[model samples]
Target: MTLSRRPAHRDVPETAPVAGPIRVDPRTKNLTKRLTAGDIAVINHEDLDQVSAQALVACRPSAVVNAAASISGAYPNLGPQILLEAGIPLLDRAGEALMTQVTEGVDGSVVGNEVVVDGVVLAEGTRLDMPTVLEAMEAARGNVSQQISSFARNTMEYVKNEQDLLLDGIDLPELRTPMEGRYALVVVRGYHYKEDLQTLRPFIREAKPVLIGVDGGADALVELGYRPDLIVGDMDSVSDATLVSGAEVVVHAYRDGRAPGLDRVESLGVEDPIVLAATGTSEDVAMLLADGLGCELIVAVGTHATLIEFLDKGRQGMASTFLTRLRVGGKLVDAKGVSLLYRSRISGAALVWLLIAGLLAVVAALAATPGGRTLYQVLAVRWDDFWAFVGGIFG
Candidate 1:
């Protein structure tokens, strides 16, 4: 079945009680998944890579089962982690079929962590409701299995550049944790981030922490309400206007100790110190800034977090991402789909207004064109046939 183009749960309350718990088992088929009024089936494959965070939010599932190595390799996405932290139970290392049993048993639980599933006992040792613990375990598994594969494949490629590895200028700065009580907004340019900045207006007016943007995000922040405190990345996505806006600039450099983006900054004659030469992508640098600046919370938006997302960008520098998260640990918050969570509740009048606007636009356009006039004429000729088909259905 096809879903509607618009989000179905747009009117759902931000924090509603999940309907009766659903039962699932990732391993077996004999086990039947339970269905409650609010229960939803979440399959974590690289599906997280294929869909937008907002799309997932629209489903409004009470919990999610992550089948993928969500916390593994060099990828660290802020979306799922944020969901977990927000009290959504995250179950990884479980297949869809097996997890169905777990969801079904959520309502009946006690004695240690064993969740009773269809008279079967699930140990607390395996099931998880906390985000941080689940993420770490998933990462450890991915690292042991995937990291070894990654090392073996890329080992020989760097044989010719042995000396290049010794360069100091290109080394990533030492990681630092964000300070207490301050929040940092890390921005990236993505679909609708510019328009979505309006959503941050409330947060900005209230929390007002350090504002840092990655490349184009700096420009985006400037367009919104707040001035950025720091700008990190290669400086390519950022604008001349943003560069001169007096924010501190940090340029990501090649692992070989080259400052590729420095010349661009100089061409613009930007006077602020551009910390050149760092490892990883710009988003990685933005995270590092939060860690290094001592900000209490790191709120990232429009940033890429999935394997597909990274592949889409054709990234070659995720090494820094893996290491950066290790430094920041648990304080990172990804606000990717916050807008969808707190979207303006569309009222009856507003939807009516939208329908009227759409109809008017179509009518006006049709009236303005001869092709449209011809199409309307054809429709008029077919009106009898159309009504006949409709009448025949009832008859």
Candidate 2:
């Protein structure tokens, strides 16, 4: 699944690129939520992270025009490679001024490196194909060691500041949803989350785990027809529709007790959302909440656990995640690993089909017997008489 990191300076097709309505957003995550297939995605995300790239690819856009560098060489980001590999056209570093030139839902086409509107070129930048993206990625990989060192330093500093999480169970707000002695399924809208969730369908149905969604993960659950038992996050990414979906809200605030998300929740008419002023990410808070509530087993889907994943998430450190996992211990399971090991038993539909086959075999055996012939004749006469009586009553 590794993409080749070499620039392909191949010839561009003579045919004009497909025209579509453009959707613009400075935040790639929020843009992806509204973007549909064939729409041109305009984003200002620099060093476009892998998770955001994957989200955009899933939407199947015709092209992506980034206002910032897709691969700024900050640290071998995989987003540009992912987009190029998916056969989507990418125009990199188109500049922030391009945002004002095009309105939302305005028809536009990607002509090579240029974004064309009604036969006029609005903006043009580097046209990234496979070879170019791959070459950039290869160069970026060399800087990964430096990034790792910085990440480690950040993690250590964070641990020093937030030691209470590791030693003592920090005081947390009370949750209305009970999680004790039950399986808590925490979902995040991160890497390969949609596929992982689909794979865990049987486990979700049978175990009936308490569904706890972190921010936009709540919207993901609702999209898949599962009601979230509890929704915890900073509240910036989640839609108002999800806030009103009856899930108990827990707003993650700053260590100094400033809750930016609290105002948004209040504006949405969500009354008395439990405001948790924590130092770490909302994901960390969710895990700690589950662990504190005495969940028997915690299954996590779409969570960022790896060093690269954290880096991709724009997180400088993973202090809280490391401590949270230590606290949860062996009780925690990754949804992808669970999917590989779990063997689905016979479904109800299969059992019904088997039952029908067995009944047919029995009927064939009975038909071959003389006593069965007499029984069939009696039943047939009774059936005809019943039908005649019903018909006569209707007449």
Candidate 3:
């Protein structure tokens, strides 16, 4: 669900030009963390995937200027279509020079089809509309067969290299938080994660699953008022505040034992953070960590939100994700599926219990009042007299 993918509502008109301070980043995920409403995003992403696209949409950027082709026709990438649907104008293939020429935090404008910086026109690019995106998607679909072949080969290659994940699980850090035979919810800040997590509030409450946040996903849990028990990732995106929020941190290190995320967490005063050196994406490691630790049910939020997205992320990391899913498939349920199958609605048994509790409360309150004692005496006298009259008639 790279749900790193998304859909959002925007107030700006599609045809109108947008202006604001520009934010520059080659990494879309990092850019999202700092983006403010109305800021123009200057990115170097090529064949922009759904996850990165959705992230940009969430920041409510005025416009996105890509230094590379947003749709290279390599695959039917969903990013451009989502941006246009949200009414955020996309200036595609503005060229690599755009990254060097424009400085961050400078005033910029997306006028007509060109980028204007301080009244100087830096570059013009293809303004993607819905029709154009649709055409590109259709054409890209034709190349899926070729991509499928390449994807399989790449996945097998990784499966050989990272076989340790399958045959023998990597050594997981000892934890104070219990995950054994319990439901574990792993959150990623991807595709409709906010909406999906909102819907799963009931499940979270009743199940009381161990909350695991993967990198930036920890911020999402905090936003929803759920403190994460274990935070896992390269430590690039999770906030300093969240890192120090008493949750045990697991720094995802390279197989070679280099952990860049460790210094940041330690500097923030997080004590005794465990380092798990593993190959593959942080999200993959997060899933394996839960399953290997004996979690009975591992529900995923914003991680492969849907099957299409799962297939769409057919890059190098997808190979690891594929193997990790195979190992955890029995317990792994997508977050959206969990929300739909069950809701927070009260059961009949619960209603009956509530009714009984209410009646007991009323009796206790009435018995405590002085006037209630007088009423009770009168009722008792009337009950005795009425019973005597009925006994005489029966006799």
Candidate lDDT scores, in order, read 0.55, 0.84, 0.85
For all candidates, the clash counts are 23, 7, 9
The TM-score leader among the candidates is 3
Lowest lDDT sum, 10 consecutive residues, model 1, at: 1-10
In model 2, the Cα lDDT at residue 91 comes to 88
User: Which scores better on TM-score, 2 or 3?
Assistant: 3
lDDT of 3 at 229: 97
| Residue 41 accuracy (lDDT) in model 2 | 98
| Candidate 1 Cα errors over 4 Å, as ranges | 1-181, 337-395
lDDT over C-alpha atoms for residue 365 of model 2: 92
lDDT per residue, candidate 2, 1-395, as tens digits?
Answer: 11122232245655347579999999998898899999999999989888899999999999999988999886778898889889888888887888877789999887776777776667777888788888887888888888778777877887788778877755767788888899999998888887788888888888889999999889888889988999999988888999999999999888898999898999888867998887678887888888888898889999988767876766443666766787777788999888876656789999999999999999999899999999999999999999999999999
lDDT of 1 by residue, 258-338 (tens): 877888887877665556555457786677656655677787777656553543333344344544555565777667555
lDDT tens digits, residues 172-252, model 3? Answer: 788888899899999987777778888999899989999999998899999989899999998988889999999989999
- lDDT value for candidate 3? 0.85
Error of 3 at 321 (Å): 0.4
